[model samples]
Target: MLRHLIARFVFLLAAICAPVLATPAMAATDVSTPWTDEDFASLRLISAQTQTGSSDTLRLGLEFELQPEWKIYWRSAGDAGFPPQLDWTGSQNVGDANILWPAPHRFSIFGLETFGYKNHVILPIDVAIPDRTQSVAINLDVDYLVCSDICIPAAATFALDIPANGNPDTSTSGASTVSTHAHEIEKFVSKVPLTGDNLPIQVSNVFATKDGDATQLHLSVDGLSNAGVTVDDILVESPLRIGFGAPVAVNKDGESNNRHFTVPVFGLNADQDLASETVTVTVIAGPLAIEQSRTVANGPTDASAQGEPLGADTMAPATGAGANIWLIGLFALFGGLILNVMPCVLPVLSIKVMSAINARDGEISRVRSGFLASAAGIITSFWLIAAVLIAIKLAGGSIGWGIQFQQPLFLTVMTIILALFALNMWGLFEINGSDNLGTAANDVINQQEKGGRHLSSHFMTGMFATLLATPCSAPFLGTAVGFALAGSSFDIIWIFTLLGVGLATPYLAIALQPRLAHALPKPGRWMSVVKAVLGLALVGTAIWLLSILAVQIGLGGAIAVGVGLVLGAVFVWARKRSQNLRPRFVFTALAVTGFLVALFAPGFSKPPAPSSVSTAATGPLDWQTFAPETIPALIADGKTVFVDVTAEWCVSCQVNKKLVLETAELAEFFANDDIILMQADWTRPDPEIADYLASYGRYGIPFNAVFGPNAPKGVLLSELLSRDAVLDAIKDARSTAGLASN
Candidate 1:
């Protein structure tokens, strides 16, 4: 019995020491043995010789071939599962080793989205060879988890040997064994995400803000949106012991072509200083993926920064601030003065002209009362606009100039008003016994007979003019309106009042100068001709309003409105020609019914899908539909972008497009492959476009801007675009980019 126990102990001791003695010999040569975990996965150790800079590096690959529906975790194993951990202590002549991970896919099992790899994957271990004169032996004991429906832990020991200076002929077979595994290792090297300077994507800015107990990272990526690229997952790779939730895209107010991602980070200590920490973000967009590193700043470092804390008490400062308030007010004044010439406001001009003509025969007191009422009307409308802006701002909503033009209801109502006014000008109807001002002699008689009501008409005309002018933006108006909207409530009111004052300046001058009215052609047959001309202008204005209505509603709704306007016009004409009071009342009732039908008919139809209305040719310089998210990418790619923010309702925008942008000279210039012409049509209500407009501090359309490599922030163009102006902007942008590159 004693002899049997001694023999058993010797046998067990040899069994334990046998594998340890054989490890050195196994590692001395390339030990490639296939490892299988049941039927789920198969892994093997492979070795290759690679050149990194001036060093001969030994590349060892832990290649895994998984069965269908099975997957393994990535380095930053999100949600669940552990990444493969390697024990390199048993390896020889290996100064250092690193596992290079490829970009992972987001797997949604149940309701959880986990990051892992399916099918075949190779985890490349770059072994640093300390001495080129000596062979290097690598041994790895890896512990990894694989999952199908359930996860299973597996362990394996892998060994590989690389000859001195990667020489294969020194081996026992005198063959290049490292070359045999070269293709397999190269396959995975290509799969590894581009890092550092090799990354194709560019990160513009990264910001961190504390939201309750979690931290939100606002990442702004350039060119991602413009390329129509969308990310599936963003993994935060950092040494900090924190957990991150799935990334949610946050659309910045004015940046349609730029991508903004909001990533929620947990496990942040209250006292942690985010400004000093570096973060690596791996973005996987379709088949392409990139890894970029950036320092997390406390606040937004760029103008595109968004995703602020929900409970913050104060509003962030406006991006535009340096302009002098007095200068902006002056611009507002000039813009208002120029607004008088816009087609939308031309109908109001006729009213002003008629008032001036009527005042030519009246006393100074009557003229003063009439002009003062008009001025009061203008000022009151401006104040009302200010009140609406304040209400919107206080409610934590965005406010822009002429934003009402985007509302279908507002457009419908304005169309009805303009249509009726046009009919009145056309002698279908008369207001306050004025006889539609069909003849100058009749107008003179009416003004003499009803002076008080005539003054009221003048007042309403001024209010109507101001209302119409809101849809058009003039030179310097953007600067003024931007300042006002971004300023305090009091500033908004004060600045808008100044704008009204500017608009009324011409009327005030005419009222103060009685000789101005005398300079007009005498009230005769010429008055009839002038009335007809003014009536045509009003009709044109109504048509313009309806065109916008067509975009807001649909073609069907627009047709209905046209029919309603015609019916209303016929009834108004019948009422004007009627001799009996009952017949006139019946005609008036018909007109009212038609007007109501016109106003609400659009509400019943579905709005048509917005389509691109760009006139640029589909060639090298094809006009892209304006997407704010994509602008960054275009600029980054060294393309000069010309952005035109226009609307169908804006008369100035149409004028600019017809007169300057669509000209042969401009078209030729835009045909350059390096130049991208993009149009943002604000013909309908679009929150994305509205927010983009607000970002530039503009609330109105006909906004043109240029973006280039150097001017990624963009340079605003004049409201009235000229051929020279656009060409000059492009030239300047190119020159700026050249300078920046130099």
Candidate 2:
């Protein structure tokens, strides 16, 4: 488990690079400007109109013709520059002025992430003017950073005169030109999609579920080409939801739209849903777009016109009496049995299988004790996990397995444990290392420890092994866990506990039968060799721990962790060297302390905060933080956005990033085109990312989506990534939105 965490950390470090460069031109429409030599310039705001239900919504534009090669910063001016700011405090009869920015380019100047636009750009503003006011005067105060090799700050205080007259000949050619430009930008914005409606994806319904006591959003989408889509493509926004990889393709019902996409509700991974009201969906299908705001009413409430229920058939027996009780128990048992084979427990099992052969001669009572101990271990571990998961779920946390690693303290604990095991295996210290006796004495010690009749140790070992195995859940296990989280609290707890029992049953059966134990080879010197091998396995586990350290502290820290392991070995050696127990105890304590401090040192360092305003090619982008409330606004604006849900430990995510996302080609494409890129990192198992993943019916990494015009909200992408795949997916999504390459 530690090894996987380290790999994920390394992947994230290698994956994230300088921000992708966006060409400001992508966001701006009909960008033209009047410019003079040197650094001076002016931007003009024009009027455009679009009809709503009753009145028309006013669209204003800021057109700037910067000197060639000169640039202006976006809302998030990246590194050292300031973004353009506007003050409409003095405007008359204008209810609101919302600046619409085009996506901005990313520049790594002196190792800084800068967002800006070059040449000419137009910033369109949405204004809600009073219907009574024929024309409203526009006044503005603006500040911006312009760069041409070197950067310079500038501001403009300007006003436009308007006669309190009729809606100023909007049909004229001049007005039409501005309207065209505004509409062009709207093309990009319109892609943020909505929920509901029968799409090519065919969202049959969206439902609220309690999976293992965790709140989840379930979206049933039909028409899957294959079951692989269940393990890929689908993505959810909220981090607090729970999901498997993707919606599992149930055996097709043979209907054209029988494929269902089960996405966990956003912010529902908690024991209780954290949502105040409403659910927003940005459905992106190759270029087809739909963005809608659906109210998240009562728990799994009847489907509204805006959001559909997952499926009426999906409702399990509301009355528990006649439920498929046998099947539920079978699922639990199978889930537990499968967990034993998961990556997290593999090594532990290896040790146990090897150890079990020797314990065959033990007495029935002893064997029983060992089995009970193992059962206890398994139960305890599962309970602990359940408790934490439930706590977080109740708290509205959005995260899944290995979430403990997010805390430096947890990483520190694992580091110390692994180091000790490694040192013991490497022979730096021996368990009862010193016994000034002949070879025969060691054999006697081994026999005594095994206790011919005591089977409890072996059983206990099994349980302990199972407990340690929780980190890496297998595929089916994730599904089971997700199901457990969605159910009632008691049911969640019982299901997990039952899973533990099922996992231990096989071993217990063998322990209970003396005939099974009597069939083993007689104990001898070979036993020492076997112990030595077990020691080696322990060392391997330590190395895995060190790998995780490398990610948190870099390669240098890994070496430090290695040193701590060595120190632990020395302590073990010292304990063996002398009969005095006090010195040994002190050395052991010191070794443990050193390992912990080294593991968490990197977390202490702080990083800069991300800015809200982002400059894109559309003009000036008014960046909005991701939230349940922001969906309505994003849909209304109609901008194509690219959302990345990443983690520090997700290796696949890094591969996709370095191999595809960081390229200049992608950067150029996103910038020149009015696309918004939003990144949500789960470097430390963030609740937010968890919520986001759950929304898509997943509990781990490598989640992605694209929001395009006409389909402006979002479209989930595949889990295993390829640059070409993403590009094609985006292109296809764009095409669905009535957009075609010219």
Each candidate's clash count: 12, 118
lDDT tens digits by residue: candidate 2, 365-424: 665565555666566556756766665454433325545444434444455554544454
Compared with the true structure, all predictions reach lDDT values of 0.69, 0.51
The list of candidate 1 runs beyond 4 A from truth reads 1-323, 431-454, 612-621, 735-742
RMSD of 2: 22.1
lDDT of 2 at 615: 16
Clashes of 1: 12
Error of 1 at 544 (Å): 1.5
lDDT of 1 by residue, 531-575 (tens): 778878777777777877777788789888878887988898899
TM-score of each: 0.54, 0.45
| Cα-based RMSD of candidate 1 | 27.0
Q: Which consecutive 10 residues in model 2 have the weakest lDDT in total?
A: 17-26
Best by lDDT: 1
